[model samples]
Target: MNRETLVEIKNLSVDFSTAKGALHVLRDVSLSIPRNRVVGLVGESGSGKSTLALALLGLLPDNTGEVSGRIELDGENLLDVPPEELRRLRGGRIAMIFQDPMTSLNPVFSIGTQLVDAQRNRHPQLGRRELLKRADEMLKRVGISNPEARLAAYPHQLSGGMRQRVMIAMALLCEPDILIADEPTTALDVTIEAQIVRLLDDLRADFSGSIVLVSHSLGLISELCDEVAVMYAGKVVESAPTKILFGNPRHPYTLALLACEIDPEDEPGEALVTIKGGLPDLIDVPKGCIFAARCPSRFGKCVEEPPLCEVEAGHKSACWLA
Candidate 1:
């Protein structure tokens, strides 16, 4: 079976109205998600990871000033699709598992009800009983025991891990072609985080869809993603296969990000590695390489912005040095 591009993003850019100026959230970003592959988006808090995700789902905030780009799903540009078609595609062809399950799940409804509602978009012909059965099986698949009773419980009734599991079950219930998990393990304990990671790993193997893991955890990205895209400020500085990116990153930003990863087996009392400078101001982004200000290897040629270009087969980087 050919693993062709399932979703293709080209020159995607987004800006928001801010008191200072137009805050460029995403800047000429382009990426490809191959079928059944796991792609990771790694960046800092303000790197616009979530914004990009929301943009893909056509869920950008009302404050968004401008959005220009082509987000193609199986060759169809979703950005140009009608509102009704886009709405149907949001949870039907594409679905998302937000960072905080507690906030993503409704406190007022039982898990069963929410799960059934989630399926209605994709399986409108299925009856309530059938949806409930499917939801029950999905909950069990996500490692939630006693699915029947758990379905009847509200989001507040479950533990943090359980709530996250419920969120996963709900997203899966949609039978989407693409699943976007935005910091799915955020705020969970070490044990629960590990569980969620393992669960995702298991699902990626069996699920017939591609996944986008939006996370700050390099460790997680290195372990789970087939490909990795590194973002800085509001642009993708580097992206490549997981091994290629981690083994031999081309951009300074990617190198700096790898250097900041915590090594569990390191010598004791070592100060935690940290990136030097903070993110650049998106309102007035630097003209040259976004990472040049803090890049230790900066040179005179970096004064002008570098376009993301292929430096090697199947690898691309946006740095003059690359």
Candidate 2:
């Protein structure tokens, strides 16, 4: 662990018990969440992005068969933390804004009740009135208009964008050191998504802690991330600073992702660039490079698994070509 990093995931792997057997969702994944930085986790669906995020908070589902490797919080391995202590750290030291507010928020509770309850793990001594006050302030901070009024509103009563904002407020209420926002804007419209992105970007000033943004949207990642880690088939295929990765992607998978991005400059009737193959089976993972079948640059060298080695200072890619 470094002085600047708040959380570190090293050699992490996860197995989920499905009907078909254990699905290896994550494989030797390592990442660093530096203090006061937004790190984006990007890749297509089934890339284990969400699994990695859930692992950070130790919130993996009960069906999770096995989880190996270290998740260090300030050099203390979170995997070793007792359940009681982990519960304390969950909302206080680390919070997460899940993908869908509709599903995450309790339908029976008012927005105020949920937000106030979110802080209970961290602020048990605070009375309901005090917690409600804190929740109101956070709602206002996240741009909720008429915060007091919205506090009484139920999740079903609020608009989609407003519900999402409430989720952000709930996450912020605990003043967590690390916030994992997994596809925070996935359910919103393009316009609302842009607003949410801008809001998160603006929050950097108010929040001095680290942020882990898990999403497949390269555009959103480029906009908010200080660094980006590109995952493919449960492995981090490439990791680099945002500007460097976006401007000069090294891995073939990363290059393919950027090429497939929807560009506004394309003329009418222009065909889109798309990757040729689908993701590999997690149960029967390839022995060699997981992306070889989809990689345009793969040759005989790809027959062997490539280590995630540094191609340049602060840039790492898991490809023989890199």
Candidate 3:
């Protein structure tokens, strides 16, 4: 079957009116995620990854400044949709597994209540017993043992990994068309993190939809995503098929990121490479390249912001070199 474009984000820009001034979070960022594929958004903290996810779901803060751009899901413009429509679409057409599952879950509510309530938004006709059964099955699918007993427990009662798994189960119970996992494994250990990633991969067979995995771990992205968009500051500096991008990173920012990845062959006590300089202040962003201050290959033209242009077929980079 031919996969079609499921989500298209075009020229998206976001700014917030803080007490000090306007803080630009996203700048003309555009991306396309094909149906049934996993697209990874890899970037450092405060790179606008989570901001983009909220924008896609029409959940941006109302106090924010003008947000310009079109977020189209299955050819429908999400930005122009009504609030009620968007709310209805959120857990049904779209769902998010947040960075901190503990915070995402309500401490007052039992896990069963939260899971059942989530599904009830779409399946209000479901009986109490049926809802419990569905929640139990989903919990099992996410690798949680004693699903029935766990459902009766509160958020604090479970281990960090268990809570994260419950969050995953809740998000997937609705079977959304788009799943935005923003640092889903941030709180898990190495073993649990691997298990969570594997669970997500396995659940894809049951969910015929696209996923946007927002993470700072390039290794995780490389392993789970079909395509990757490398974000810097607030812009996408490089985007391409995962293999192609890793094999031939054309952008300076992307190359620097790749250089920081751990290598198994590296000798003991070798210091890992680090990207020079800090992220630019959003309130006083430069007119030039976002990475120009730290770019080793900086040139005269880099003093001007470069458009994200195609460097090769199906590969694009936002650099003067591209």
Highest-TM-score candidate: 1
**Per-prediction TM-score:** 0.95, 0.94, 0.94
Q: For candidate 3, lDDT tens digit of each residue in 1-322?
A: 4658999999999999898898999999999989999999987777899999999878898777978988999888898999999999986989999978988999999999999988987788898789889999999989999998999999999988899999999988888889999999877877888888898888877778789999888888888898999998899999999999999999988888878776644421121236777789998889899989989999999989999999898799999987
| Candidate 1: tens digits of C-alpha lDDT, residues 1-322 | 4659999999999999998889998999999999999999998778989998998888889899988989999999888998899889977989999878988788999999999999999988999999999999999999999999999999888999999998888888888899999999877877898999999999888898899999888888988999999888889889999999988999987877777665655421121136776788888988888888989999999998899999897799998888
Flag regions of model 1 displaced more than 4 Å: 265-273
Candidate 2 wrongly placed segments (more than 4 Å): 1-3, 265-273
Please, what are the lDDT tens digits per residue for candidate 2 over residues 69-99?
Answer: 9999999999899888888898799999887
Model 1 weakest 10-residue run by lDDT: 264-273
From the highest TM-score down, the ranking of the candidates is 1, 2, 3
Least accurate 10 contiguous residues by lDDT in model 3: 264-273
Among the numbered candidates, top lDDT falls to 2
